[model samples]
Target: MGKLTRRADFLAANGGFRAPTPGFVLLVRPRGDDDPAMRLGLTVSKKVGGAVVRNRMKRRFRELARLVLPEAGIAGADHVLIGRQGGIERPFEQLAADLRRAIAKVRK
Candidate 1:
């Protein structure tokens, strides 16, 4: 998973974020010539917890993005994965499915 170094670029160039019903927050940025290798940005707000709790959510987002992004063909696109308020309690499979859907939407 490449890092989402150009955060501002991603936010500016791509489509606005999408919230697909119950499970995920999908931020979609359009493809560009200088785009990194299907990069991902994970943001866990303070509302979730302190550093430890937020870090854990970030870790989960990283793992899932690595596993799913490439397969979804996220080249030239930037995606930021934000954890919901009820994060730890969310089912893993549901999270995965939400990511997959987000990837699909952005790729289109």
Candidate 2:
């Protein structure tokens, strides 16, 4: 898996499929090319809280991505995980499960 670094990549994924879970929103889009890796982006909006809270949510989302993406992610796709208000307080295992479900949903 790789990181989705460019603004265009994020916007493209946002324009694709969206799956909303309790912890976050998952966006996915195919690259439409030969790249075999799945790319990931994270977004934690300021409306969720202040910088500290937003960063904490991002940290949690990053860890969840690392745990779930390798086995569950779709190849040649860009994925963006958008943090929600309850993300910081959600249990790690639950968050992971949410991501798993979100990936499945987006792929379908």
Candidate 3:
């Protein structure tokens, strides 16, 4: 899997970009008045599943972000991906598409 190394680098410096009730674990931060390269954080709640499941979900999110972030061109925003219980059953391709759409919206 590719690495989210650049996104991680950005997040270490920027704080967080937050929105409410994002659909899946691979979406991007919403549009805002910010100017830093986008970074991503992954959050998997315990209520979603057990520790193993949570960890797996987080890994999936991170990996997806790594693959998609470069094309996202979302500069100057902090992004966080929260994993929902539904994500465990959702298809990865759809999740990736959702992420791209989110990034496109936020870039506008």
Candidate 4:
């Protein structure tokens, strides 16, 4: 429902529950503000690739979030997708499935 633009938000999410997939690590942190809206953040470090690759990964992630997060994401929480080296090579369908699986795991 929103984007997390602050470094602090991302850092806060780092301390939350994590679900690791082949492509990415998903982090879910409840804000406790009772807003009922989910905020999303994406990170692709230089360790993964250069700017172009990172941008592409982010674009894919944005689309993935659009498709999946509305239904699967936790309410009033920050959800971050941390790109791994495997992410750029992974199939889009597989990545989507990975995200879904991550969400399911975090919900438990």
TM-score winner between candidates 3 and 4: 4
Give each model a TM-score: 0.79, 0.95, 0.67, 0.98
Off by over 4 Å in 1: 13-17, 34-36
lDDT of 2 at 11: 84
> How does residue 19 of candidate 4 score in lDDT?
98
lDDT of 3: 0.63
Candidate scoring better on lDDT of 1 and 2: 2
Best by TM-score: 4
Q: Model 4: per-residue lDDT, tens digit, 11-61?
A: 999999999999999999999998999999999999999999999999999
Q: Rank the candidates by lDDT, best first.
A: 4, 2, 1, 3
User: 1 or 3, which is superior by TM-score?
Assistant: 1
Please state the error at residue 62 of candidate 1 in Å: 0.6
The RMSD of every model to the true structure, in order and in angstroms, is 2.5, 0.9, 5.5, 0.6
Compose the digit string of candidate 2's lDDT tens values, residues 1-30.
789888888888989999999889999899
Error (Å) of candidate 2 at residue 49 is 0.8
**CA lDDT of each prediction against the hidden true structure:** 0.70, 0.89, 0.63, 0.96
> Model 1: per-residue lDDT, tens digit, 29-55?
655677466667777789888888888
Top model number, lDDT:
4
lDDT of 4 at 103: 98
**Which residue pairs collide in model 3, if any?**
35-76, 36-76, 37-76
Model 2 vs. true fold: TM: 0.95
